[model samples]
Target: MSVSNPTLITFVIYIAAMVLIGLMAYRSTNNLSDYILGGRSLGSVVTALSAGASDMSGWLLMGLPGAIYMSGLSESWIAVGLIAGAYLNWLFVAGRLRVQTEHNGDALTLPDYFSSRFEDKSGLLRIISAVVILVFFTIYCASGIVAGARLFESTFGMSYETALWAGAAATIAYTFIGGFLAVSWTDTVQATLMIFALILTPIIVLLATGGVDTTFLAIEAKDPTNFDMLKNTTFIGVISLMGWGLGYFGQPHILARFMAADSVKSIAKARRISMTWMILCLGGTVAVGFFGIAYFSAHPEVAGPVTENPERVFIELAKILFNPWVAGVLLSAILAAVMSTLSCQLLVCSSALTEDFYKTFLRKSASQVELVWVGRAMVLLVALIAIAMAANPENRVLGLVSYAWAGFGAAFGPVVLISVIWKGMTRNGALAGILVGATTVIVWKHFSLLGLYEIIPGFIFASLAIYFVSKMGAPTAGMVERFDAAEKDYNLNK
Candidate 1:
């Protein structure tokens, strides 16, 4: 990258700051608990922003805006679904998970939680959940890698091949060094950058396009149906867009935030803060895409970049509309978005392999120091795998994220929700839910069935499997007692 270029310079500085934060957090990371879960010490604001940042990823700035730019408001049903889903997740799942995971056994990973909560002596739940985390998280990490590479390729004129490795380097470094605490701390900073970019970019776009009236007129002249939400769409299409919400219930990275919150009481305040941040960021994303339709229509001379790849709408707009120094700051938000989520995902994957697999089987009596090193090693191993997966320049951020998001939501969402609410949920039932949910998503996506989002089928089938398989047998008295105790604490805290 040229020192003469302000944007590249800003990116270097921002990445350097993140690594520095990781170094600081590393000193505090004394054991596996600190590395994997911040020793469950996050406060309300940190939990709120970190959760929102990790949840949005590059999808908020790149994928979702690109979708709206390509399809207009017809695509915004996704925003609606996501907003509703997020609020519900914070309300229903956040407190319960915080209480239950701690109560069950102070579990560090989702697999650990499942095995502990259900008393899976055979370790089947841990293995299956860990397998699912590995399979899906590898793909999820690739999406973040792809997003970062896209930003670097555009800004620094690096070839996609070179950008792939370049973009992933800093995220991998900090995550490998400091683990979860590093990821969460950086996420708070990234979330602030993302909102600033989203909010500022759109207002300027609207103003540049001669305000809302001229923008809407231009949009109408270009595509009359662009303003209609139900235009050029089927019932199934709308429902499919809204189905995106269901996936939120099952996302492991977001759930990890809830698990890491200091207490259920902190989660109460965090829910409010997180939802407000989410709604504003999402609204700004929609505004950027919607107003982009008007700006690009009236100024087709500069629209070729966006027309060729709609995902670059925000990027192209920032470079063209702002001064070099201002654009540098604005563009760093993309890197922030990419790194924040990618780092969290890498840490989560590492925890899964280390806590759930390596520590459980390879070294049952391993010391905390050994486990921490193993976790760090797993972060490197997973990042390399994700980089290789992301090397193909043709990968789309939205598509990769959708696949992984569905897998987690289907396989774990129903089980997590049901386990927390129903004392009768059995091990066999939880196992059945995971199998069916994961299977349905893969089969549905493979066959392109019903032209519907895979998460819907996967979530429904998993919930059904859990209910039916559970009814066929009785839960042990020990299971009922455990659930009651967790429920009592959850009620007291909430």
Candidate 2:
């Protein structure tokens, strides 16, 4: 496939800039702690943007805009749910987790945090949580890869198979090189590019389609119901869509940002900055699709790609509407979104294997330098697995994301949230919640039961299991004492 020289040059520059950032961060990384969590030294802006960028992923630019393009506003329940969930997570979970992870022995990963919080002597919590992270994160990583592949396939005219590998290459390179600091630093830049594209593309789209009113009229003329939130969906569908928010609690990549903040106080300002950025990006994403509808409806002759796969609406429109140079910059935003999230997910998976598994079981006395190298190796290993998962051309980014999101939300959300906030929650309770939540999501998704999203059932059941099982058992004195110290520290910090 012949590519536009301008776009090809832009992509080259963008990818190089990302790698340069990774190289810069490599100098700051000296130990396993630095590699995995930046030694918890991230300031407010870096922490906030990294959290937001990593959380959004390619799904923000590709899957989400595609979903809105095909299903109209009815699909935005996920967006609404996500915005609400993220805000709550920032408010309730961020500070507590930062303080708790520190007090719990300077934990670097979610599984480590869980194991330390519950005082589990048997290593069950660490094993199960780490496995869940690996399992769901593999799927989550695949979604980012698929989104990147789609972007590459459409933009550069690469075949699906070629695009899959090409799409994951840059992300894996930098993540392997720079570790957490690199991922976090690059994320801030990517987040800026993403917001720029999202904000700019939509305004251009609006102008191209005449205006907001004209766009609405075009949509209304085609299908008035397109503007309706519950247009073709059942109440169950609405509930399912909104359930996406619950996944925020269990996302390891986002939580890692919270844990990496310079201080608990940093989280306060980071929350405000993150939320503002998120709201703007999401609003702009919807605008891209909403306005694309009008622009395409009037120019059906050039809408073949979008008509064939609605997910390509943004990609197609970006190329058609902008000058070649501007289009190159706008299109790089998709790559930015893909790299930001994929890098962090790779780092989190790396952290899980290195901190939760290898360091814990293989070499209890492993050197910091050895552990950092091991983390870098794990990032490559997981990226390969995810690339294999994304090899199929028919895979949809949103579909892959939904399953993984449900899995994490169900398996880790209740456990993480309850463990930090409640002192009386027992080890057995945490274990039960993890099992029940993960099982429910897998089983519910397999059976297609109730036409409801799995996260809702999984979250509810997990929360219930923790409550009942904790009521049945009690925590040890040491457990309570540890919780008291963590809680007191959190209070003082907050």
**Pairs of colliding residues, candidate 1:** none
Clashes per model (N, Cα, C within 3 A): 0, 0
lDDT of 1: 0.92
Candidate 1's error at 35, in angstroms? 0.6
Off by over 4 Å in 2: 1-4
Alpha-carbon deviation at 404 in model 2, angstroms: 0.3
Residue lDDT tens for model 1, 366-446: 999999999999999999999999989999999999999999989999999898899888999999999999999999999
Q: Residue 168 lDDT in model 1?
A: 96
The residue ranges of model 1 lying beyond 4 angstroms of the native Cα positions read none
Q: Every model's Cα RMSD, please?
A: 0.8, 1.1
* Clash pairs, model 2 backbone: none
lDDT of 2 by residue, 1-494 (tens): 44548988888899999999889989999999899999999999999999999998888888888888887888888889999999999988999999889888788898888888888889999999999999999999999999999998998888999999988999999999999999999999999999999989988888888888888899888778779999899999998998899999999999999999999889899999999999999998888877777888999999999988888887898899999888989889889898999998899999999998899999999998899999999999999999999998999888998999999999999988888889999999999999999999999999999999999999999999999999998998978888898889888877
